[model samples]
Target: MTARTLVMLAVLAIAAGTGWLSRGWFEDAQRLTALEAAQAAASQALARESVIAGVVEARLATLDTHQRVIDRGVIREIQKPIYRRVCLEPDAVRLLNDAAAGRAPDPADAADPLPDDAAAVE
Candidate 1:
């Protein structure tokens, strides 16, 4: 064979080998790009979830404080007036006096209301 023909054959062989190896490299590069894109998407989704969780936590804290204020303020306001009225009733006052004197409550007094007591209840 001529020297030029042998050199041409050698160049063609090297070119074929390079092309075969480079095909796998090109596919790997494409796969790496796809993985990077997927990672970015996942990071964005996590950020959104974190923001939502922060909002929920803040709202829960606000609701908890409001509920505590209602329990302390509104319930106390209602109970104070009701307790005052209860304390002023004749039976309650008598019972409180007897208890202060360390007397046992009269069973008959609790069981049978006087006519005036029944009328006052209405």
Candidate 2:
């Protein structure tokens, strides 16, 4: 063969070999890029879920504090009027005198209702 022809044939052979060897590498690179994109999407979704959870926790804490305030207000309102009624009753003076003398107050003069469990223990 002529020198020129031999060199040309050698070049073509090398080019074909390189292309064959690199075909799998190019396919693997495409798959790796797709995997990276999927991972990034999953990370963003997890971050959004955490933010939603934090907001719900904060709202629940606020509700708990408001409930405590309402409970305290109701207890105060119920107790205040009962104290005022006891103070203004016409028998208040006599009741104080009997208590100071250590005599047992009559059941009819009791300010509060009797317990349902009072007879249960006997």
Candidate 3:
């Protein structure tokens, strides 16, 4: 081979080696981003679940107090408000509305007044 061919081959070999070594770096970066996203989702879910559980516990406690304690008509009995403050963002509201909205009640779902269209067509 000529000197030029040898130099070109050497350059190609070096580039291939560099690419092979760098491949792991790209894969590791991808894995790291995915892991971080998963962790964030997990943390958010945990916090949301904990808050819901606490609300349930508080409601239960309120009910229990109401049943167990016979309050004398003394105006001294302070009643704590046990209201659930649900603040949904626009996106959250849209999601909830979408989920709650069922498919429009099709006429077929009700008692069929007439022979089925499919049957008539057949």
Question: Mind giving the per-residue lDDT tens digits that candidate 2 earns over 1-122?
Answer: 89999999999999999998899789999999999999999999999999999999999888744333334444444567666666566566667778899987787866765689975876
lDDT of 3 by residue, 1-122 (tens): 99999999999999999998899899999999999999999999999999999999989888733346667785565555433224544454554565589534444434434555755753
lDDT of each: 0.85, 0.82, 0.75
Candidates in order: C-alpha RMSD to true structure: 21.5, 22.7, 20.6
Total backbone collisions for each predicted model: 0, 0, 0
After superposition, which runs of candidate 2 have C-alpha atoms over 4 Å from their true positions?
A: 1-13, 65-122
> What's the ranking of the predictions by lDDT, best on top?
1, 2, 3
lDDT of 1 by residue, 76-108 (tens): 344575667654777777888999999999868
TM-score of each: 0.47, 0.41, 0.47
**Deviation from native of the Cα of residue 92 in model 1, angstroms:** 74
Question: What's the residue-level lDDT of 75 in candidate 1?
Answer: 44
Model 1's number of clashes is 0
- Please name the candidate that would achieve the greatest lDDT relative to the true structure: 1
TM-score of candidate 1 against the unseen true structure: 0.47
Weakest lDDT window of 10 consecutive positions for candidate 3? 81-90
